[model samples]
Target: MAAAQGVRGCLLRGPLRARLGRGCSSGAPVRQQQQQALVAAPAPAQELPSTRRKGFLTEHAAPFSAFLTDNFGRQHNYLRISLTEKCNLRCQYCMPEEGVQLTPKSELLTTQEIITLARLFVKEGVDKIRLTGGEPLIRPDVVDIVAQLYKLEGLQTIAVTTNGINLARLLPRLKEAGLDAINISLDTLVPAKFEFIVRRKGFHKVMEGINKAVELGYNPVKVNCVVMRGLNEDELLDFVALTKNQPLDVRFIEYMPFDGNKWNFKKMVSYKEMLDTVRQRWPDLEKLPCEASSTAKAYKVPDFQGQISFITSMSEHFCGSCNRLRITADGNLKVCLFGNSEVSLRDHLRSGASEDKLVQIIGEAVGRKKKQHAGMFNISQMKNRPMILIGG
Candidate 1:
């Protein structure tokens, strides 16, 4: 029956429309049915088992403490650690306007545990780690977290993705802590619209933080902007123009669906659309070479001080070269950003799982990664945790 029904069986469809109320825009109704029908197909029989028992990892651990490689043979070295799932701002796309139930502090990973897990991954050939959160800086000890991750051996890069609310004040301490890169999330240039979208009144402060990051010599201070149709879509060229003078790698991400965002296809402005708009304005825009595992389809405007990137996770899926593994604040490992599948490392670590045992768990988790996220059109099936709970 499952095979007969195929991928559509995995979708969470019926309740979405009723839940969306009158909030969804014009094209949502068409997408609602079409997206649901595009759910993920069943896994192949030869694929890794869906088992999550404690002993599974201990038995099938890979040799020589190598880095994680999924069934598709993609090597994983980059790790995104969600320090905490708490934020000061309430962005429209990230969560409900009324806000989400915050996770209790006791359930989250402690600083020591985070370090231990990070050290294990580093030892297993993981070279880079990026700290993320509902807003990483919200945690009182975020600077300390950066300070500690910097001290780990074999970990080459220490980066953070912040909303820039608390960033301006913490710039000095963060720079001193050996932080390597900073990615700020700023969706709009209009102060009023910014406040309306983020549900906060600190647009100037975030801009100040971006300036401080650039001024302090944080090379290529990347600014991430999520472009939605009715919302900030008109600012596509405006965002691109930011690169004309300053050294900002402005990234435009297509709007994605989640549990509470009331996401509809009408909201997303595709990568091709965004690029064409920019190209029409600046015909000399040149494509930049991207690393194998990069999610963004990067490009640079000739003679411009900085570059512009497109994280086309929606329209153009980049899963073929994916090399990332995410650890939620509460210690669950998510191999893919769009899928709901996860394994809890916190349970094993706290249960006295040895380093070897932990490595086994990591390997098993990576083995279960999906080929790609349900593409943009089929994203209603991706009813995973909201972006806030999943980090960034």
Candidate 2:
């Protein structure tokens, strides 16, 4: 019976055995040899599992780490740090007659302190930083501050938002210090109207600063215009026309309610009305896309060198995409613009909080971020802290 089975196996292997390289006769011993050959053959190599491949360094790369807020969310990577709570102009929509209490000089963060905090923020994924102020240009050592901030690693851009009163004298020094851009607040183009709106008589100075900024190659020099109903709202087109000849970016911001300006809803100008007014005359105006965290919705007319931007903070809230974390001159971390709640980094730092502890505190503050600002006009709960105090 064994011999017959071997002969049957040899018949089956008649043509295939030569390729496998072995005995090729048709007999019982040959059949047994073929069976041994089959048993000795290695199984086809199985593929390396995906999990094992992922574990290999060549297949898996490190992920980019971001400054995560308390709610386990990542932000838009921008920080606006206010240099002071003082300003030379008294724009009715921004500050009151009896100016808001100035943050004590002792309490204010020193340049070194600010730079340290900025470096830490950059380490944790803050890519852009804008130095703001009641007027940042008022700070005595602004040039040094800008130069120092420029040295922070991972910091892609550094800018200053000023009233442009002192820009002409400091423009060269500021530009030399690595300031990437400037946003000058000039609400009115008319000399008399400018004084009425800002309560200061320096229209020519502001214009000169704007012109100098342009001449010095301050790309996209932004002119921030706050549109108040009875105020300079009439000059909307006049301001927009500036963009036709120059390479300026003129932005009109909606008036907001805060302690500084005593914001009233009646005086507010809706962004829609402003846009409609412009489109009425400049029928060829086109809306332009802005960056993710940009407060303004930009637009430009055909064949124009200048651009217009509308910041509808009051009429059109863009809170869902808010990526800004503000540090008041006093060093308090404010997560939201209208938020009354604050985390005192000054107190923590003075209390001997380690750098890691300060970072953790910032993370917690960001975690408690409100999804949207409770409209200052709608909510009866007044913060009493004006825009100047909050670093508008």
Candidate 3:
């Protein structure tokens, strides 16, 4: 989980050009100033009155909105929209090696439908939207989608969670289109292992994408690594070493079960295990403050320019302050990532539901959200969509 987890920051140019400062450097300690501008934007902070989810949006959350707030008073401000389910690579963990039954193109949300839902969410008090996919860069009009979302008055940030295959050539266009943050999935630092994991020959391309993102001034470009035992776990330090000079937020994600990919407890690398692995190398690893809604437990090594974090979705869950809502590529609104229940926004839109009617449907779905998802073991056993379909 990266954008699939949550996103932070805003664009320095394009639609947000008037609001952000201009300057690019590869030497900044962290987010530097572009993010500061986003933080100072006119949108209200995401503060929730609830004291349950510790360190979450207390004073920093936006004003409560009936449509966005759940029964627990967790004000949801982040929305992740899956651009498409089609992926160029066949990652072993993302989809079954035999592959999944792809949805017909006609069933997927059209560009306009995505934009319409985006505008609706912005009006409903959702400030951050992350574009996800089997690989979002595969879509030809993704840049245009970001452009349209950026133009929304109250929308504060636009991010993409990509496999980084086509990112090298498209990042500039995406930035010009008002794209703010990016999360690239790279589970292995080794080229051969990359091919083995993704079942594709695009390691060089992914590496190129990472370098290009940094070169183009997307500070703290998030690198998502799904840590699996007996696989790429040995390269944890190699991934962490990436943050020594670059402004990359290297996030280690715990592998969770879905409909396929054969997820099991043995493959999971817990948060504590990952933290201990990194701390063994850098005894000075320091814990960084994180938002209550944040799924990743952020940390940074002493004097390191970038930081390292862990998404403890398995070993430990952060559902208490959960503020994220996901829309599948086909436009089904999933309130919880692990929850199988969904309401079809695409179906409603296609059925000619009014804006107010759609809002009511979305609010009803949000209202039914549980205080938390099932435990890790139960989640693995329960039926859920594959990570690829869920847009993680």
Candidate 4:
């Protein structure tokens, strides 16, 4: 019986030895042989907790034996996590109506869950995290979530994109929570026109929020404007005027299709048109070098207090340089803003998946990412999911 046991062990060692070649040897010291055997064997597959895997597809199955997907070959390092699906205002381009299918409060990720996921993402080489939402500030505990995310090891910067309705109330807390910067969505400077576009009379509130954000030392507070033809397009110069005395970085975004908005082809604002308009006003506008993951082609005017950026999503798509992966309010991982498909992380997390398993799932999801988004403002093949449901 002992001879038979020895034979079985020898058979196992034979295959491992062949695989390792000269790197492993059975004739080595007993301690060294044992070490090689341990290295040859894969880590034991432990089942994820039942509670954690509850919502996952493989709940009844044994824990996944192989977790890592393709190595970080397709390195998309930016992540955008939507905190909520409820916004205060209904911008004509963002949301046409007030009542949309908001994700139930219970379905949203808890602050703890968000922090855990952020840590996991950072560990997997994600360097930047941006908090977005229907309005990120609308989420009551956004500050706490941001604070928790700050504790992550590998994250380099954290930003929030908000509607600015609640910025005044949340700015201090957000800064305290280690928020690096903010992007406030402001389409028009005229109060009545702003009310017309956003369908809200709280323009002053948003402006106040921007002012308060500046006061709290948030540098480069960006003002995002969706330049739509014949709508608030006439307010182009007025929007530019915002940069005169303030440190605001005003960005003009070409309207894209997603929501049930009145997105007509003719109404689309091209990057060329926006550049021409800006140059006609300020010919001294010069191009500025931007960070690797920045979607916008940033520019600065000579002796100006602030800068301007053009996001040519409609005219000159930046999908090639796109490094963002969006996590929806309910935990669906989206690889592209234009794609309809999603990888359900909520299901996996609810299932008792281990951190390593979750990382593999994410890597798999990202591996299948499309090479580019749908062509410039091509809405025919667009997904029915609204932008609010997708993080900005």
Candidate 5:
């Protein structure tokens, strides 16, 4: 994640976007002066994570002088910024039946405010940033935001996780704005199933957008499928077949508990179960090499064009090597996805806190990070935001 901002001309990014494919290239000029950015930001701020080892990720576990680094000697170089909490789809697994209460517009970060925080994190040690939300594309200024983030000198990869409801139309503009990686959420292929899962009518639009992403040369377009026990477990083979002919990375995520997701142990699917199920069909699935900080366990078929992986968040937590940080749409810094504790960076910033003060706030919150999140059973009982509100 410490890799710097030189991944242009179809260059592959760090562990954040591990799918195999050539990424889009862009060289647009930056206009940082136009925005109300942090004029008093740390001077001589690093363009990359470590000035000692520039333009490359610090592969070893050695500690660096990054503010994002916690006490456990983990350096967080990947930042997930929630663009908004408003999603176009209401997937049964992501949201509760009653739905999440939306954060007020006045409390949310403006485009300029988001840019400020992004700049701050990059200046600290963040090299890769993934824009997430209920649906980031729904934001009218998403393309502009992408363009601005691309302009950051030392930031390496710019990625987004969307439902693909509006990707087909804005993909060209987004690609031109320097988006290096993308993960589209598609839990079901059947149109009726899609509608049932999301409680919406954009199944065709989502499929069209996926095809468009593949057509537009986003190599190894990642398709995120949240696997549930009775709902979509039977479709695992169908998802694996997708990788046979295309550079698609179908990641089967384990169903997890959120505030309203009605998570139960019975609904959860373990990584071993999914792998065993696949091995039954092929009997020759190959494990792929990945970085230590990677959350997904990647694998592929013998001669398939694509690969598959599993996010073992429930059965097997990857907190020991976690190098990621999350910022809610409302500007709260969440050190862990399963942790409900948060520090309002928005509050500090709005109160006219200086750059040094902001660093102290961020460091304090990061310092309070637990060695690992609570167990699945305990986490289900804890109160936390729904997945949609927290940014998928």
Candidate 6:
């Protein structure tokens, strides 16, 4: 009642499709000019032309509808942008309490660059974009970015994933800028535990943000909780209770390993363990069919007003249906969340690579997407930036 809320892609290759319009010469200046033009003028929304070549995805194809498709036949319409690597809180699982080193402000992608790349993806068939960050709300220009992205022709959804600290202040402007949904990360129900996990004294602020989000009619406002052994695992039931009255989606994620988190297998609270715990408390809990491309396995408590989902990225891999891509704050594209490979769109953009070249680079990278990530057994060998740097 008192303590709630809070805490916390790829490339491909290809020839320039005709409908994509206005191919540019290969060079940094020419590409920058073309990117500038795109930012200046977003194409009007319309059906994309059919692309039926044996190696390409057909227009409007359900799963592989995007202009870029991987070897596994996954269409990627969801794009996650990391606005910055600088965060306010030092979550135990995300980064060091002392803070990790960050890229210089000059090197991070500019709002214009983000818009340019976002337009390219939307043109290529991305319909959904999520703004993420060390703390997206911390970036003063985030609302403007969201407003610009909403004007893109084919983009149907704009969302943000935040720690909910600044959401109270930013939600109205973001909502006005065409934001569609929000996912707030609040790992524990206890203020002391929240302070312990996040290494900050912002629990009340986060709760206020959550309450504001609900008040503002952010339908299906999601609360993301990362459950770990010997830590917040005891709060699983407490989180589920959140959905009983409010139209929230309380997602419990398995504790995952990344660089500098001191991760170990013993710390993971498996999805099965979580589901069982919920069932024991609510024998009538119902499983809900989830979107094929969604990472979570969804459920609802009988007569509950909201839902619960489990992002079993570690214990249960959903790679076959994974449809999301990530662009780091500095402009590298990550096709797979757990993968180490990144194609630098920022470098290419600044170097003056043509839009067609950028498309080709993206396609080639997506082509190399693995069928699945190396699981728990090889978890130690997987190299990745800390979760904060990688974006939530």
The backbone clash count of each candidate, in order, is: 0, 3, 10, 10, 1, 18
Error of 5 at 135 (Å): 0.9
Between candidates 2 and 6, the lDDT winner? 6
Better of 2 and 5 by lDDT: 5
> Which residue segments of model 2 deviate by more than 4 Å?
1-67, 70-76, 379-381
The candidate, 2 or 3, that scores higher on TM-score is 3
Location of the lowest summed lDDT over 10 successive residues in candidate 2: 21-30
Candidate lDDT (C-alpha), each: 0.76, 0.71, 0.79, 0.69, 0.77, 0.76
Against the hidden reference, what TM-scores do the models get? 0.83, 0.82, 0.86, 0.80, 0.85, 0.85
Top of the candidates by lDDT: 3
What does candidate 5's lDDT look like per residue over 1-392, in tens digits?
12222111122222221223225521111222211121111211123323433322233322222356555555677789999998888899888888788999999999999999988877665667899998999999999999999877556678888899999999999999888778989898788888889999898888888888888887778889999888989999999998999888899999999988889899888999999999999899999976566788999999998899899999999888787899999999999999999999999999999986887678667757777889989999998999987885
lDDT of 3 by residue, 21-101 (tens): 323322121333443333322222233343432223222332334555565666676899999999999988889888888
Shift in Å, residue 134, candidate 4 = 0.9
Over 1-392, each residue of candidate 6 has an lDDT whose tens digit, in order, gives 00000000122221122222212111111233333332221122222222322323332232222345565556676799999998888899999666888999889999999999998887776766889988898999999998898778656567888999998998888888777778899999899989999998899999899898888876678889999899988888889998989978898998888888988889999999999999999989999974566788899998998999999998888887777899999898999878899989999999999986787788778767777888876875778888888886
TM-score of 6: 0.85
Prediction 3 global C-alpha lDDT: 0.79
For residue 171, model 6's alpha carbon misses the true position, in angstroms, by 0.7
Summarize candidate 2's per-residue lDDT along 167-258 as a digit string, tens digits. Answer: 99998888877777788898887889888888888899998899989888766789988888887899999988898888888989988787
Per-residue lDDT tens digits for candidate 4, residues 44-107, read 2223333432222122111111121111122355679999888888888777575578777778
lDDT of 3 at 210: 95
Error of 4 at 344 (Å): 0.9
RMSD of each: 13.0, 22.3, 7.0, 14.1, 8.9, 11.6
Query: Which is the leading candidate under TM-score?
Result: 3
Once superposed on the true structure, which residue ranges of model 3 sit more than 4 Å away at CA? 1-62
